[model samples]
Target: MTSIPKTSRRDFLKLAAAAGGGLVLGFHWESAEAKIMNVIHGGTVAGSDISFNSYLSISPDDVITIFSPNPELGQNIKTSFPMIVAEELDADWTKVHVQQAMLDTKKYERQVTGGSGAIPHSWERLRKAGATARYMLMEAAAKRWSVPASSLTAEHGVVYHKESGRKATYGELATDASAIAVPADVKLKDKKDFKLIGTAVRNVDSKQMITGKPLYGLDFYREGMLFAMLQRPPAFGTKIKSVDAAAAKAMPGIVDVVTFKNNVAVVGKSTWQVNKARKALKVEYEPDGAAALESTTDHDQIFKKLLDSSDPNVVSVKRKDGDADAAFKTAAKVITKEYQCPFLSHSPLEPMNFFAHVRPDGVELVGPSQTPDMARNETAKLLNIPPEQITLELTRLGGGFGRRLKADYVLEAAELSSLIKAPVKVIWTREDDMTGGSYRPAVRYRFSAALDAKGNLVGYKLRGVGINAGNCTREDNFPSGAVDNLQIESIEHKSPITTGAWRAPITNFLAFAEQAFIDEVAMAAGKDPVAFRLDLLAKAKTTPVGAIKYDIDRMKGVIDLVVEKSQWGKKKGVSQGFSVYFSHRSYVAQVAEIEMKKGKPVLEKIHAAADCGVVVNISGANQQVRGGVTDGLGHALFGSLTFKDGAAEQKNFNNYRLIRMKEVPAIDVHFVNNGIDPTGLGEPALPPTGGAVANALFKALGKRLYNQPFTKQEELKGVSLGERL
Candidate 1:
């Protein structure tokens, strides 16, 4: 029997003990793989060594583990990323297991998961990771059989010598393959040769998730760890004045109370006790007295003032092609409309939380974060230590939607743990997450179109005003290249209230406003909405236009697919709306169908078509499309956030409306496979949904809505389409 090394992961934990005698957490792939390898070998090779790479490991018993480097925010990248590797590896899907990789900047680049860039950024790298492994295995087999590597073929974790009728499992050759030199370049499988890329593979974590297993950051725990809850300023533009924690300290289960920055934190034995004590503590806050924070009403007036003003300080031209003023002056008719969208909260299912142990020797931080690399670096900066001293592990995120891209929660846990000199888990109450600001910036847009006497579009103009958000216009986006004279301008209001990226960012609401404006212009031009868009695309494809950012062919591809799939004009007695948008490098088109219920318009179904290149996993792709569309529709119809005196007016679901399960319309998803590299799917489908629903609603009600949360309009106020049904 071979002698296996005894210096395991647990032993290393003992090696890295802190000054206070607490164990410092560390992870090594070999030490962690021992138990898993044992199971695969049926307790035979429990102590045997395995061949592994930075991204993958192959046990002698045929268990192939692929490490997914990107953070998973329910985007299914965890499953789909590995599928990309497995497809190129030609590994059997049944023998594969996926694990989330810890933060290692040297091992993997771009670990962040926001902007739906994970797949597109990692596609080639992951494919090469697998192909390199397969190439090494083939080389090993070729050496053993005395045949050229070019003649040896690898398939489904096996190397075969077809001429000699000899075959060996990848497990049997893994040891030799480990010694083989990895080729600098290996051929990637053609898309048509893939068996797993387009297949509907089940999510690896589905069973564990459905069984209510402990997987998310909230579920993480450490021995001798204390739970913490924070008491932050009640409203934006406020700072802590005083803290009285005497009564809180007397409360049962209370451990200690401390203040950091401008916030008070309560430490206790249990979450319930910590939460109860946190609320019991008395904390006073005074006005920060910086720039006056703008309420929703203030933003409304500010946006109105900036829309028509050309103040050099507030307004700047984003893009200009030809002379828009000259074209508008010569036009026969000009149509103008203004649209507004309120601030929105991410409201992911899981509230913010993180676990941290700030030991002297090293730091162990674990939690759900969309940007784990940033969290690690920020924590290191806060501790005044090198980033390599920190070992950060990622847990499955309950929900992110770009909210976890910020490291405030993670930093809080790190700072609290450092302050208390113990392992700590910080938890945020639903109220805390909601009231703690990081909202989508509220924005307003004014669009004007000029038409010639022949009913052809001659010029276009757009001016957007946003609170705290910079440059709220996608100047190079669709329709920019289609018009002869175009101008886009942006105005910014520097409000004190904090706001950050939310899902699709500016395009989330911009798509709706722009698409709805296009619908209106189409009506004014006496043309069908779909035909009008197609005409613009055709002009963009053929005519000389100033720098188009989107692919005209892909946009038209999705538009054609959606039109064909939805039977756009074939359905009778049903009001239909059409919208198409290109965002995040992907093109999406949607058609919303509304059937009249009494006098109210009830959304019956939505058809979505996307051209995001090749679909890695059909099941996950479909889920993303459906989820995005549902989220977009719900927010367009009911989502709204307002501020009063620099404080969020709605704190919980009761006041902050979300679309009910009963309100979700049936959604059908289709993908256009053009054999190109995958782009973004998580957010592309969402941007067009609002426009589709709004356009359909216009047809149903014979009135155009210029603002979001259409329910806020006088015609829709207090009217529930669900209640009508």
Candidate 2:
């Protein structure tokens, strides 16, 4: 179980009279008797100055409203967080309503939601808040009945005294409960007593989403709001030379055309008008800086140069164990392999968009952002205002995948609003978004291993290189403490193109390379892949080299579950491959079944076993694992993002190939149930999918694919399997 920090009790209470005689619950955290009160008071309405400090409220009509503090980006945090509170409060789930909390740094210790950290960070805090409320309500009921609080029992928003057959709804006692002081220590429910925590509940806004209601950032609108579109530079590392806006200004509904640092903006009355004018606008760029970045071929040459050259300045040691040089010297067998993966785009369903209203006193912005507080601070710095002067709200995001972590879009909206001197909305077209270039940096990996005469592994080494996307190295990753005489080194090359996190980040490609190489080593030794990995895990459990961040027993549990569920070594007619990886504090194992269809590799089914501690929502957890498998397979089979002249070659879906509906396979997901605190599920399931599929393809076609997008253009044609064999 994860340990939670202890909070001290102090004078952190402040109550304001709420409209409609509702009861507000305000919680403050104290460390060593230093009190910091965070309070808010206002009506429950859209676009109102509601109190930011209040997280829960009870009205006179038996309604309980809970504010969810994390950002929702289709990972279902909005539903999961409130369920935690309801479980502790013993409130009726059906009578509870959820509201998205505005960005308030003081009110929430952390408002940013990325890396799948929200649930773990808020689990203990929210449970305490709910328990505190329930305690106050029980005290009020005991005072009214002239009985001890210990004799009262609260269940489903009602306090009952079985001895006297007396009961009162929480709403009926809201007025009296509001005056009671909060208790420093409250008893929390045991796991066996939970009713809503592990149950599957539909998303709170599912009805609104299906009915086409306004919920997403693109769906936001305001009266007198203008629409704007940007025409960014054609390539990276280049600035706009000149702009010809005469033809665009003559278009209907065009408002104004202005040039900014790297792009030109076209403001209009509606999105259609702005899009039309943007197409008509002409712009020239100075391409001298990006002259060397002509193609992916050039980037590959740079990577090869870095890989072959033994430049001490470029190489940085990430981790080392024992003496790899001595172990390799006496090895009987040595194997080496090189792997590469292309850049990728987030390509969320909804393109980047935000609405901003800048004024002399402050700036107000509403949009879908993973880091709302960071956006507020950056906008403040750009507008020359205090961070408190900027107000930011989070809407439902179509999808984040770590792309929304960057506040460039929010900053752009604020800057445009300040210039236009009115409320404005900035929208990015599909083409603009694809070419905007905060891409998942392409990476290269080289691996080497040594084995003794008995086929026992002795030494391992890995070197990686990438562009701008920090070192492509994770020291605490799997196979770290598992292997003795291990060394990991990384080199980063300079590139003007912007790069950022994508899905699992470095683990995405690293797992693919590492696991695939492990499979090759196992095959060379004539050993079962599943058994080989299990042996290593068992060895790590017994004698680990350093601090093992992952639990080897938990890792082995998921692997054993997957192997059993998948019926390993029992299939006679189909080819199958297995892989296991750990990341983001979660363990996942996957198996891919593949066969030939029309001379191309076709995935028939996928079996996955996930051990992410306790499953919050069974249905949502299943979908997350399923979606991750599909995403990983699609990218591994045919997804690639190339560059030409420092510009992305694939501008839209037409050029960028994604997995079609017909290509999806039946995915079977299973979870290992252990009552521990929940870990992240958003990214751990993705890293193993690629390696599983690649190993399956090797079994079917007798070919080893060194590069990603395993099915090349020539391979897509009708080629006989016998020829490759």
Q: Which candidate gets the maximum lDDT versus the true structure?
A: 1
Give lDDT: candidate 2, residue 675: 77
Candidate 1: worst-modelled 10 consecutive residues by lDDT: 18-27
Q: Write the per-residue lDDT of candidate 2 for residues 572-619, one digit (tens) a residue.
A: 767898889988888899998876766665678889999988777787
Once superposed on the true structure, which residue ranges of model 1 sit more than 4 Å away at CA? 1-53, 148-151, 718-725
How close is each model in CA RMSD to the real structure?
5.8, 5.1
lDDT of each: 0.83, 0.80
Worst 10 residues of 2 by lDDT: 1-10
The alpha-carbon lDDT assigned to residue 364 of candidate 1 equals: 95
Q: Residue 130's C-alpha lDDT in candidate 1?
A: 76
**Candidate 2 has which clashing residue pairs, if any?**
40-51
Superposed Cα deviation of residue 638, candidate 1 (Å): 0.9
| lDDT tens per residue, model 1, 18-42 | 1112101111222221111211222
